[model samples]
Target: MQAPMTAYKRAWGEASAKLIRKELEKVRQEGDFSEERIAAALRRLGCGRDHGVHLGHGFYSVHTGVACVSGRVAKDEVTSKVHGAYAEPQPGTGPCVENRGGH
Candidate 1:
């Protein structure tokens, strides 16, 4: 027998979400949200150069292969979540994309 496609999608989504959360926490602790820092963090978490794009003004959009996780970066505040702007992420994906939604 074969597993359903939804199951695979959900698994990928969850993985993507987890990665985003993990990196975001580290970013928060570091207290730096510069473009370089954010991009490096996302890259460390498996985001390719093309996948992570800066939307300017501290806003960013990143696609982590299976799901999209994005948010804003500021000195006082930093936010990150999974937002399926480019494409609908599978169920269980987290939440933000600058151009799409969840800013």
Candidate 2:
């Protein structure tokens, strides 16, 4: 059985998706749905930032065609590669940094 919060989140996610689709349709019919315009509409619909809709990290809007992390396939090769490097520390491959002076 799913927790109440999980169920609620799923429901909300679905509703938000529907809303986005509707807005996109409106934009298409109006022939004014540029990428920026779509992004603005999404923001107005509360689909960006700290909103519940997690459209992938670094993904600000849907006009880019980048779906949310949850919307991607768990076993997708591209997703696997991206997720693999998400948290691991990156070793310095450039010139060493030395502290010169402290403010």
lDDT of each: 0.57, 0.36
Instruction: Supply candidate 2's per-residue lDDT for 36.
Output: 62
lDDT value, residue 82 of candidate 2: 11
In angstroms, give how far residue 31 of model 1 lies from its true place. 1.1
Candidate 2 clashing pairs, residues 3+ apart or interchain: none
- The TM-score values for the models, in the order shown, are 0.57, 0.40
Candidate 1 per-residue lDDT, tens place, 1-103, comes to 1123356555675677676667766776788766677778777866755664444466666655555556666656556665344443323332223223343
Candidate 1: residue 69 lDDT (0-100)? 51
- Which residue segments of model 1 deviate by more than 4 Å? 1-7, 73-103
* Candidate 2 colliding pairs, count: 0
